[model samples]
Target: MNTDFQHGAMGPRPPDEDAIMVLLVDDQLMIGEALRRILASQPSIGFHYCSDPNTALKVAAEVRPTVILQDLVMPGVNGLDLVRQYRQSPATRDIPVIVLSTKEEAAVKSEAFAVGANDYLVKLPDRLELIARVRYHSRAYLNQLQRDEAYAALRESQRHLMAANLELQRLTKVDGLTGLSNRRYFDEYLAAEWARAAREGSPIAVMMIDVDEFKRYNDHYGHLAGDEVLKTVAEAIQAHCRQSSDLAARFGGEEFVMVLADATPGRTEELGTGLCRSIERLRVPHLASRVAGHVTISVGGALAVPEADTSPIRLVDAADKALYQSKAAGRNRATMMPEGVA
Candidate 1:
């Protein structure tokens, strides 16, 4: 074997900003070292030399070499075998492999290409041709690398934007003070529920609750204390609305609303009465009210099977009328709306 390798010539010069990594695999230690020194002298090429095909594969994975320079005749694993191995491994499959060999036969060249060799170069080729081949492949590899990085970055940004949009939607519909759905969300939900109830011929119930003597309590205890009372009362109401279809909301100052899906008139009244009793039991000391010794709530309930002719506002108004009746008849009591009205 004529292994009289040319060792002195420097490889292709690398770009100052970005250099292409190249892997040189050969069984002869002198041949591998010569190739490494030649390529290392080039400013634009980053060369990794391996005497074993397995070690070359390992280095290819770690460095992601842009170009592979393989020697065909080796003792253990030949250059053609190494090319097959590189092509089989997903990590190294796309790397371009050029076979450097002493055998210049056309049959040897054909076998090299059959095993996935990208280019075939005879040993001791002209230095200028070697440099040109390396430079062309390096530029192509750099282009692909840039494109892949840009695509990855774009996908990451899209994911972040989607997450931020979802967070914004959550904040918009959620009440800051009580962590329940706000009035805006409640209105939208009521409309949808009304439509569903009409289609299913199921009863939908509305409950309007007013904190007894809330205005007087705010005046006597200050707004901060009133806020605390409101939060506590909101929690109490939410506790009573345990079902997935039940919705509780703060319907403006000292007043709250609940929607009970598929509830009967009697069931609505029972739930409303229970909620009123729970608030009364809270006994948040409010000495200013004549109706009760402590803080309490009056509830007005209405239940109806929704129809195409019925609107969400009608249900609210009916509940409001019943609530007014409760306040007038005497505070701290629950009243049910008349059947025809709701």
Candidate 2:
């Protein structure tokens, strides 16, 4: 059979800047040398040869060849059988294969083509034809490699962008100094939790906290000292509500809010007391305070099973009232709203 392989069958696109790797599986060592000389002028083409047909697959895996040249007849192995095996392998399935044979009988060439041979050629092809086929198949192989690399890179970039977007969303709702959710996040979270509680028929609790005599502390210790106290108090609140669903937020200067979902009136009171004790335990000196010798906090708590007609604002208002009641009765104490305030 005359070797007249068409170039269009190679690939639609040309090769990229990367080098192309080619593996030759010819039992005859002389044929391997001839191939090397033919491809020596092409700098971008890389070549590997295997004289033992049994080791061809191993060499193909090592080189990860873009194109393979197989000799049809060998001592113990038929090149056609090797082509079938290569086509079956996940690593070599996509690689193009061309078979080299001494006989030009049409039946033999047909069998090679049937067994996954991309093209059939007579041994020692014309130098010009050899160069053309090698370059054509090599270019096709590198094109696929480049496309795969680009797709992988795009996926990685998309993953990084998604992570950055999530962080940006977190920052928008987080207080810079106290590391607690800001007022904006608190309001939104309260409303969403209230709605969810209404749907689930569960009770939600709110705690309104105030720093006892904060102005006097700031006046005596300086504003910077007051800022540190707020941060410490915020941390204490966070430590108290370690549950994933619990939210402790800075409502504003000197005021903070804690929202708890599926919580009971008793849990509310207990957490409120714990928060007060935590602040008092800080021992942040508040000598100017009338409430306690050290820094202290007043807590107001309210629990309600939300209804369709009720809004989260009602719960917040109730908690605020109780906070004032705590200050009025005495600071450094936790007080729940009067029973049946709604």
Candidate 3:
């Protein structure tokens, strides 16, 4: 509530680039004012004053003064007690405290030092010596503060770098066009899934999808338009392929691949049918498609419980044969491979 204590006398103006602050604490109004005036004469130091120990503690957290000049004896809370309190607080613990007292006895000085005083000086002592000591400690305090700030900044930068690296890793595995797994990622995932299915004796289904008359559609519409169509179809197929075990990828050009782990023949068929219906609902106009309507796709699926000796190439061949059947039956359909084909 006391503005005089809250806002101390202005010191010699610091340069625009750099300024050091000092806090002067004393219960006596005259002593606080005199200290502020004296410190203000120093060009590098900015002075703050507090008559109450409580106010000084609060200001220590807010202003973060470099060097604290505290009178050892006071009416209520003495400087030694203030020094102890400041040293205990995490916020102001590092700040250097110089105890100012009229008591010049060694016992008084020892007691002040034991209470966490960094330095001790008698009241109204040698002005030049006092100013020299204040300057020395203030510079040291500022240097320490700068080091702490730099460390905090470095830690923050490391956190940001880690987050960015994680995002980059995620982007690498994801397809840019449809937000599905890319071909490279799908290849790795499929191989892992196949190995797991073989180990667990679970059925896995592989489907190869081809957009009917895709080359003709690309010839009719420019490559950009073909890309847009491909993206749309990919989205449709991905929508129908739901489940944590389901994997989809753009398999180059207008062809795509899907893997369904732990699926039965019936489940594979149902999923294939659902995907066919989803593409039909898209209503993407493909005038050049071989089918009766607009854009359409042919899906060939092969379901098998892989063995330890089974090769990846054999599974792909089975799926490719079913895709051929879908093309032969007429585009825009799903076909399953014969059990003994591979």
Could you tell me which residue pairs clash in candidate 1? 14-43, 14-44, 15-44
TM-score of each candidate structure, all chains considered together:
0.56, 0.57, 0.56
RMSD of each: 15.9, 15.0, 15.8
- Candidate 1 versus truth, CA RMSD in Å, comes to 15.9
Which stretches of model 3 miss by more than 4 angstroms?
1-152, 339-342
How high a TM-score does candidate 1 get?
A: 0.56
Candidate 1 global CA lDDT score:
0.81
**Which 10 consecutive residues of model 3 have the lowest summed lDDT?**
8-17
Worst 10 residues of 1 by lDDT: 1-10
Evaluation by TM-score, superior candidate among 1 and 2:
2
lDDT of 2 by residue, 1-342 (tens): 111111111222223444566678887777888888777777776677778888878667666777899998988898899999999997778788989988688998888888888887898988888778877777776666667875367557767999999999999999998999999999999999999999998888899999999999999999999999999999999998867889999999999999999887778888988998888888988999998889999999888888885789999999999999999988899999854463
Tens digits of lDDT, candidate 1, 1-342: 222222222233222226676777777777766666666567766766666665767766766667888888877676788899999998778778889988689999999999898889997656677777877776776566556765367557767999999999999987888777799999999999999999998889899999999999989899999999999999999999878999999888888999999887778888888998999888899988888879989999888888885797889999998999999989788999866578
lDDT of 3 by residue, 1-342 (tens): 333343432443211223566777877788877776676677666777877776778877776676788888777676788899999998778878999888688998999889888998888657687778877787786667556765467557767999999999989988887777888898898889889988998888888898888888889887888888888988887876779888888887778989888877888888777777778887888887768557888999898888886766677789888999889998789988765354
List the global CA lDDT of all models: 0.81, 0.83, 0.78
Clash count (model 1, backbone only)? 3
